[model samples]
Target chain A: MLVGYLGPLGTYSHAAALQQYPEEELKPYGTLEAVVEGVKNSEVELAVLPVENSTNGEVRAALDALIAEIGECPEIKAVGEVRVRIAHQLFSRSSNVSQVERIYSHPQVWGQASHWLSSTLPGAKCIDCDSTSQAIERAWEDKNGAAIAGSAAGSVYGIKPLIANVSDRDENTTRFLVLAKQPAPENKQHTMVTFCAAQQDLCKTLEALVSSGVQVTFLTSRPLGTHWTYRYIVEFAGALASEQVREALAKLNQVTPVTVIGAY
Target chain B: MLVGYLGPLGTYSHAAALQQYPEEELKPYGTLEAVVEGVKNSEVELAVLPVENSTNGEVRAALDALIAEIGECPEIKAVGEVRVRIAHQLFSRSSNVSQVERIYSHPQVWGQASHWLSSTLPGAKCIDCDSTSQAIERAWEDKNGAAIAGSAAGSVYGIKPLIANVSDRDENTTRFLVLAKQPAPENKQHTMVTFCAAQQDLCKTLEALVSSGVQVTFLTSRPLGTHWTYRYIVEFAGALASEQVREALAKLNQVTPVTVIGAY
Candidate 1:
């Protein structure tokens, strides 16, 4: 089977993909849209994308990709999820931290390491790259540059960490979801749905789900893109096949557009 | 009065600050954390920061800044809000679009203009800069580069728009909140609150607010940073001084840790 993920290589998404399909040929896509497109175009059997992080909020690019692809590929659904502990390490070609004049990493990585960066290398310039591994690649090529990436990136790029476990928070983690063209099994444990409810009707919609005893595992709002209001993505504990979930979704549909992204 | 906002002028935050406090001397800070620090240190009486966008969801940097400042400045509260329409223009030192070989922009601006960029400048390299105005400054100094920024930046940086309204969406808007040491006036119309609730307790918390007829106006979640769960920020339609809102919050506090960011 072919599995797709966002990468240069050695990204957290790559790690998650490996955990999900250890033996499969993993293909790296430059962007989330490209990964979704891969599944939509039958270029890959499954795609894994980061949904949220313990230290960062929802991954907007992945969520936005789903919002944009809703009409184009109605069959896409989340099949399963994997949680990975995130540990950012400072990798460098130079053995000494003082020799590093610039640091390269994804912008989000900069946030996770900002506290350490200011105290350790206050004068260093931070250059944002497309991905952590890409940052590692650039830093590897530069004489006076270092990068913040996972140990996997360090190993893949032939760079060594000057310091390890540099992330500010100890409990940092990322939740990734697997997407495919098939619906989840009927016996799945969780269901994820994306819906468009107007700002005025938000409370009523929440009431519908809560009143049904549908344990809302996660709830987040994204911009509707065409207006100033928001569209919500909710993950609930029961499958769509459950009677309670069906009734709740039916009531929610009375107020706004609803789509079952998948059950897992 | 002095107002602090994200700097090097001509940014949407600058526009929002100008619209809200036209008479105040606008102090430009290099980062959102710096702006918040200015307010905490009384270097500025009020600080304006972007919270969310109609096209993008929440501004993570602003949210993270608030999270970091929560313990240090418990007195900080949101005083008011300002909405600014974001119209990204392709500004260039060159006379034609074809002459532009590279594009410079803040990462968020790249999202708003990605569709246009892929079609118009398929071969151009996108370089992320610190801010939109900073991107314009760099582009202005480069012979074959263009930047994506507002008209204010174009005017301020002595560059002209090669094409206007280059944003992919028509109704791109950003919502910004004003922060200050003083609490919002008791008569303010809306109240905002941030709370920490375990993922399992989310439904119960929402049910409590809904059952109380609290009319949740807005809701967004952020990572708790220290744990694998989330901290949610909710904006509702009633002031904290109102008996109904007070009772509702009291009930919510029974389930989770809650803080009233402010009423405005």
Candidate 2:
């Protein structure tokens, strides 16, 4: 099976893809939208995309792509999830960290490793790249450059790791979702839904779920292309096949149209 | 009054500060944390910091700083809010847009103007800076460089706006909070609260608020330094002094200790 992931390779999404489909053929896509598109077009059998980070909250780009694409292509659904423990390392062409004047990485990586960067390389200029692998490639070519990435990216670019686990949080992890043309076999572990409702109806909508006795595991709100109006993405612990989930979703749909993204 | 903001005089925070205190002495700080520190230390009478953007959702760094600082310094509170309409422009040293080889801006600015950048200057390499004003400074020095910033930044850096309103969304706005040593005089407009609760109690906690008849205006959840545990920040259309708000908060505190960030 061909699996697509957002990458030039060595992204956290790539890591998650590898973990979930160890022996599958992996293809690199430039953006989350493209990865979803690959699955939508059947160019790839499956695709992996990062959804949330332990410290960064929701990955907005991924959520945005999923919300937009799933609305149009109802067949495409999130079928599985993989959690990748993030471990950032400072890689350099030279072993001397003091001489490094420029550091490069994805913007998110820079934020995760900011505490280490400030304490160790306070004077270095931080540059942003599209991916951690791209950062390593750039560092490999620059004389006074360093990059923060995972061990996989460091090995890929033949860069030596000068320091390991530089992120501020030791247990930082990212959650990745596997998207396919059909939903996963019902497991009763979790169900994800997205909907938009007026402020007055939000409580009513949420109450529908709570009164059904399903625990909401995750909830986030994003602006719906307007100033203060918002749409909510919610995850609850239940299967669509269950009576409680079916009843809850029915009531939720009555309050506001609910799109069931997936049940896994 | 002396006001502090994250700035080099051209950032959006600077614009918000100026709008709120046109005649006050404005000082620039390097980060949102520093802006909060300015108020905590009484170095500035008040400070302005961006809290949420319509396009980008919550400003994580700002929220983190506010959460961390408020825990220790309860005297500091958000007293007022200013919503600044975000209008991004492509500013360049040269008039020829085709000649621009690099684009510089804060990471958030890059994301906001990504659509325009991809369509207009598809080949330009984007470099991240600490602030849009810093991006303007970098662009000013590079002959083949352009930056995405507001008109205020363009004027400050003596760069010309090659294109106007490059953001994908026209009604994009950022909500900034005014931080001071004391809460604003009582107003029944809005109140903000934050707290951490287990997954099982989240519905019950929210129900407490809804039962008291306060309309929840905004709600967002961030991981509480753990894998799945989360803390929520919520905004409601009520005042702290209002009977409904006080009753709601008291009920909410029963489920989870609630921190009233401010009422404005």
Candidate 3:
């Protein structure tokens, strides 16, 4: 199946998409909206977008895409989740890191730029860009500039790292969710879904799910950005082959209005 | 004087603006660009915009505004800095905590949300919003939904807390910078400045600041989102009156080119 994800090329999003399905060719979409749109339009069978990071929490751009697709039911659901270790590299044409006064990279890459600035190119000024790979392109264009980006982004942008594997932390990683236009991956061990609650007691609803034998793996919530209503997203494991998952969902139907955005 | 901030109302930006000159009628603008514009056009004499937060780093919307106004030199520097403790309330119309099914709040409020989501909304789902106050407004409208937002946001949105003060760390607070077209307020002890580095090694530069006798009270770095470099924002106590800070900065000038975004 064709997989679409956010990227100019060599972005963490692109990497995560490839990691989810090793054999599938990851199609790089310019934006998250486009990735989701690709699925909606049947251009791609599945899409992968970042949901959150271990340290940073949620990626709102991806979350927003999920919300926009809520009304478009059965279009997307979590098939799998990929964890990616994030390593930032400082790339430059100049051999000396100290000679780099200007740094270029995507805004997210720049967010983690402090350590590199303090330790390496301490005097470098930062400029933002559309993506990490783009930073490499700019760095290549501007000899005085270095870039803060993924090591792979360096290769994509055709630049070399003055410093490699230079993120401040070793465990730094991002979490990406797999999506598909069809039903969530079938008869599997995990099922991911998003819903709108009819009532306020989300815990109460969750207890109901647990009581019905659903095994929740990951959970998060966000505001619909509408009149005080919220949206709930849950990932649970129940043999997707079993009707038990559907039965548990039926219980939620009795107590509250639950619209499953997607089923893994 | 009436003060406006970048907000839709009940955002941290509004609270930060209010803290500087409390009892001022604080109007929330839809965007930071608007907040700067509000000051430029004299729709409001002063506005509060978050320069950077301790947690997620700089507020891109604000920095981009300043960059766009580079030539105009808004005659503004950060007048004051605020570190507001993030106290999140789990608000639902129903007093029963168990009745809450979904939680809504801004990304900044996430630290406060983990407890409630783990202990309370774990079974429910999570969603992200542009602001904490907006989350409350949405949650307040849904009977089954709850919000993890600021106390100020709850008060304005008419959301009743199922639980009060839920942050992973009590120190969960955000720092905000106050700005105006002209000087707003000053403490001889503190001067907030934004600068571009001659080098990206901010840590070493900060060390130089220390060696030069600059006592840094707070420091934050963020991606400029321009081409590929980031901006390092720092706050420290030293009299601009002393000319010592400038001298130290001038010394740093040799190490890196410095563009003082603002100083007051």
Better of 1 and 3 by DockQ: 1
The better-scoring model by TM-score among 2 and 3 is 2
Instruction: Give candidate 2 regions above 4 Å deviation.
Output: A155-160, B157-160
What's the candidate order when arranged by decreasing TM-score? 1, 2, 3
* Candidate 1, CAPRI quality class derived from DockQ: medium
The number of residue pairs in model 2 that clash at the backbone is: 0
Model 2's DockQ score? 0.61
**C-alpha lDDT (0 to 100) for residue A217 of candidate 3:** 47
Docking class of 3: incorrect
Model 1 lDDT tens row, B1-264: 999999889888888888888988999999988988998999999989898887777787787787668667888878888889899999888998998999999887877887899999999999988899999988988999999999878777776788998998988888888999987667777888888877799987998788888888889887777664678888888877887788779889888978877777
Query: Among the candidates, what TM-score does chain A have in each?
Result: 0.95, 0.96, 0.82
In angstroms, give how far residue A164 of model 1 lies from its true place.
3.2
Candidate 2, residue B65: CA error in Å?
A: 1.3
| Model 1 DockQ (Cα-based) | 0.74
lDDT of 3 by residue, B94-126 (tens): 678778777777755564455547875677766
Model 3, span A38-113: residue lDDT tens: 8888788878878765434457668767767756655566666788878888788888876777888875655455
For each candidate, what is the lDDT? 0.85, 0.86, 0.65
DockQ each? 0.74, 0.61, 0.02
TM-score of each predicted structure versus truth: 0.94, 0.93, 0.51
